[model samples]
Target: MNIGIIGAGAIAHFLLEKINRHRHENLRISSVFVRNKEKYRLLESAYGVSLYTDLEKFLDSDIDLVVETANIDAVKTLLPSVLKKKDAVLISVGALADEALLTEISDLAHAYKHNVHLPSGAIGGLDLLQNAHALGTVTSVSLTTRKPARSLIEEDIDEAKTVFEGTAMEAIRQFPKNMNVSIVLSLAGIGIEKTSVRLVADPHIDKNMHHVEVIGDFGEATFSITNNPLPENPKTSYLAAMSILGTLERIGQKIRIGG
Candidate 1:
């Protein structure tokens, strides 16, 4: 697996550390795309890999898969090229709220015959939702992201209050950067317009906690995960990086443990 990562931030560093620790076979990090080369040059030097401060130069590399570990805007920027190749996994799925852009990407993928990979962000049950959605109706899906006070800007948040409560479409419209889990859940079960979201900022909590509840014909499910923020990138979860590494491991070999 010759992988090209979009961001060399905490998620990139953390995932690579875990990858090196596990010692997987036939794995290579061919290239990385970072906005700031000087800030992230150490990673390239340490791994002995190519670094692309320029987006075009990075996309031209002979990497097999492009894993988007960057923020939402970066994901939107690199999506077209990744879809051109048909082997890309997008982590910042909240960026797909622009139905125009989403439709464009979908049309392009269908024209070229590709797959857009949407990972279950830090939370699980996406596989179940995907299957259940294919059958009957998934009536309700809700995601609540509870993060520390620091995660939100003063304008976007209230002190330990429910900052957002509406349909998932509205949540994605309002909180483009913060609430990616809503978009992920929306795409999996119901449409974004139907799914719902509740965002809270709790000063008492130190970590980013995600509580998800689903109600459908299949059954009802509830999942909660508290993600410790990465030391390097406080905006991202440590588990977010780990989840990307997990996906990369699964992509390489047939040692299928968990589906």
Candidate 2:
């Protein structure tokens, strides 16, 4: 598979290194698309991949898949065009919080015969939630996220604080970067309006923590995960980047394991 990347950030760097280390015969990173060619020229030389500021040229390259590790703004502006040309692996799951945007992307994907893959990201238990949802048995899903104060706010804090509590829709609107996990959980179990979320900033903890709870006819289930931050970026979880690799591997498999 020829892969194109849409960002020149930390996740993009991580993907390039890991893919080179693994040397997957089936996967080759062909190109990258970014706004500032001059700023990101080093990435091109480092990875030996073509970098294009022109979206047209980038899309015209020998790429079968495009991995978008960019933000929600990039997803809104670039994804429809990408899906028209190639299948995409989207890491900015929070963009789907916009109902109109989700509908538009879904329609585009259906019309173009392209698939938009969403990774499980920082949290798990999605398979169980999806299964229960398929049976119409999942009644409630809630996520509580605890992160270091630096990740959530600019100022130093002496103690833990509940920053926000609301439905997934509201949470995503408030903390777009930090609450993408809630959006993923909402999509798997219930609609965003029904899925609850709580955000906490803790000065004492080092890891990004997530607590997920589900209730339904299948019974109650809870998941707790403590994720180390990526060394290059404290705002992102290491597992979130790893999950993209897992998604890429799964894409090549004939026998799929889970939802």
Which predicted model would earn the best TM-score? 2
Q: How close is candidate 2 to the true structure, as a TM-score?
A: 0.96
lDDT of each: 0.78, 0.90
**85: Cα error in model 2, Å:** 1.1
Q: How much is the lDDT of residue 114 in candidate 2?
A: 95
| Residue 22 local lDDT, model 1 | 45
lDDT (tens digit, per residue) of candidate 1 on 1-259? 7878888767777766655434447667778888888887888667767889876677678788888888788767778877877478888888888788789888878977887777777677787777777775788888888877666646444458877899888997887877888888888888788887888878778898888888888888888898877788777777776667767767766677544
TM-score, prediction 1: 0.88
Q: Any residue pairs clashing in model 1, and if so which?
A: none
